[model samples]
Target: MMFEPFQRLTSRTIVLSQENIDTDQIIPARFLTTTSKEGLGQSVFFDWRYNTEGRLRNDSPLDGFAPSEFEILVAGPNFGCGSSREHAPWALSDFGFRAVVSSDIADIFKSNALKNGLLPVEVDKKTHQQLMKTPGAEVTIDLESQTVRIGHDWQTVFEVEAFARRCLLDGVDPLGHLIKQLPTIEAYERRRDEL
Candidate 1:
């Protein structure tokens, strides 16, 4: 069996209005030059979050929050709208973001997140804008119903790639998904090996 549908993600929300935020922005190319999740957190959106000297400053949009404290990222249209780097999801996951809510996402990026267990939910422009302004925008991603509720009245219907949704619902890794039929796999392997 795969991951039983997720219940909720309750944590601090990060607001990222700048759209077309690509993989490089999430984890710069320079950082991509390391494999450790160890320091990737510090480099997430390094260009936007820190200064030339690698110092954390308070003059940015994502101020007053750190990676460890934030779990939800509310971003603008076409968020994650750039290069198809798998490292992007790695950085987000290692940084501790359980999910991301955006107006839209690049096809590849969305797929990448799903494999890492990070949800990429789509809420239309109106809901996206509203979520941007919702102080703390506590987003509850209900996998059972495919709806995202931001407080009481603010609810939006979200969609994901069908296979990705199924993967999340079943908690099956890409290969584990195939291995889900272990009996069949074992039978086939035995037959082939015996030959």
Candidate 2:
């Protein structure tokens, strides 16, 4: 599927102020049985979202954002810092998070997220603090300029790899981007055969 290109996103924030939120915590090992991403959202952060009785926790940020669709998740430093499981990003995307803003993100998780149409926007510590300071604040992410605008007066630049940025802006996954270049690839192959 051609993932929709990300340009500008304006949404309320859900603060997940936990550091080193590994893939297992994001989506436990037990929930990884499905080949399909469908229904994974329900299991995203399964342990934290539910209590011992399998009830939704009253104070969980997932609970607060569940009723409403919050596009941005402002997480603590070293977000997604566990095993390199593609399922983590799948679960987050399935959960309807468009972007994850943090001070840092694990390399593998960041790559997976970009491939799956989830923007991992990294900002400075100060910016992260500001975001957490105001829960439910409206945040704007501009992919074109690679900037995250917190409020009317506060804006911070975030870095994304050039190729990944292009993919996101074009609304195409990496595979889709390669497929679009099939004609060029074919021509190059034919030229090599002519030699």
Candidate 3:
């Protein structure tokens, strides 16, 4: 899937300062029935967003905020830590989150997120703490510089895999990246056949 090209993003953040937020908490296992990525946004954080009767909880943390208003999710440590479910990132991306910021993100989740065009930004402990404390702060994520900056004073660097960064900058998934090389691949094949 070709995602929106992520060169730089400047947006208000939504802070979910709960550690060990696993994939199930992101998108419950029951909602994983369909292969489609569409409409998963409604079910993202389904358990926390609704009651047993399926009504929106008045006291829910997300009650007052709009997903479109907050594109970056500042999560607590060990975010996306449970099963290696790609659906976690799928639901997040579908919910209009372009990036997830944390002190530490689970490895598999990071990989899944990158492939799906959801940037997982791993920053230092102090930076994460600062972000957690400041809810709804406007931040800038510059994918080219691998930096996250909050206002004129605070800024931090994060790391992502090189190839994944390239793909994200180009707005292509791994498959899409490979598909772009088709002309060269066909030329190589033709040469091999001639030889």
Candidate 4:
């Protein structure tokens, strides 16, 4: 899926400091019936967002915060640690998060997130602590420089897989990136056929 190109993002963060947040917590298993990415935003953290009676929870971390105001989610360590579900990132993306910052993100989850246009930024423990402590702090994530900066005070480098970074920079998923090279691929095929 072609998504909004991610070059540089500067926005306030939504901090969810609870560690070991699995895919089920991100999007409960019961809500995974639909394959559509749309409308899943409502189901993102559904259990936490609403109570048993389907009412919004008063103590939810996301309470009183508009998703539009926060593009980055500074989550606790081991974010997205459970089963490999693309739905996790889908729901997050639909819910308006462009990136998830953490000390350590699960490998499968991170791969799925990157493919789905959700930048999984793994920072050092100190940086993660700083982010977790300061809720609603303005931060900047620059994909080109591979750096995450908090104003002029703190800045740190993060690593993303080279191909994934390229895809994110161009705002294209893996398939989309391959599609863009079709003409060259066709040319090569034609030459091989001629030979």
TM-score of each: 0.82, 0.88, 0.88, 0.88
For 41-147, candidate 4 gives per-residue lDDT tens digits of: 88889998898999988687676778788999999989999888789999999999999999999999999999877899999999999999998999999999999
What is candidate 1's CA lDDT for residue 75?
85
Local distance difference test scores for all models: 0.77, 0.88, 0.91, 0.91
lDDT of 3: 0.91
What lDDT tens digits, residue by residue, belong to model 1 across residues 1-195?
A: 455354566665778887788787887887776755464665677788788887887776556666666788888778787787778887887777878888888889888888888898888899888888874766677876888887778877887778777778777777865767899989999999999
Query: Higher-TM-score candidate among 1 and 2?
Result: 2
Model 3: per-residue Cα lDDT over 1-195, one tens digit each: 766788999998989999999999999999989978788888999999999999988575566677788899999999999898898998899889999999999999999999888899999999999999998999999999999999789998888899999989988779976888999999999999999
Error of 4 at 67 (Å): 1.3
TM-score of 2: 0.88
117, model 3: CA deviation in Å? 1.5
Judged by lDDT against the true structure, how good is candidate 2? Answer: 0.88
Between prediction 1 and prediction 3, which has the larger TM-score?
A: 3
Q: What is the total number of backbone clashes in candidate 1? A: 4
Candidate 2 local lDDT, 86-140, one digit each (tens): 8898988888898999999999999999988889999999999999788788999
> Which residue pairs in model 2 clash with each other?
5-171
For model 3, the run of ten residues with the poorest summed lDDT: 58-67
Candidate 4 is scored at a TM of 0.88
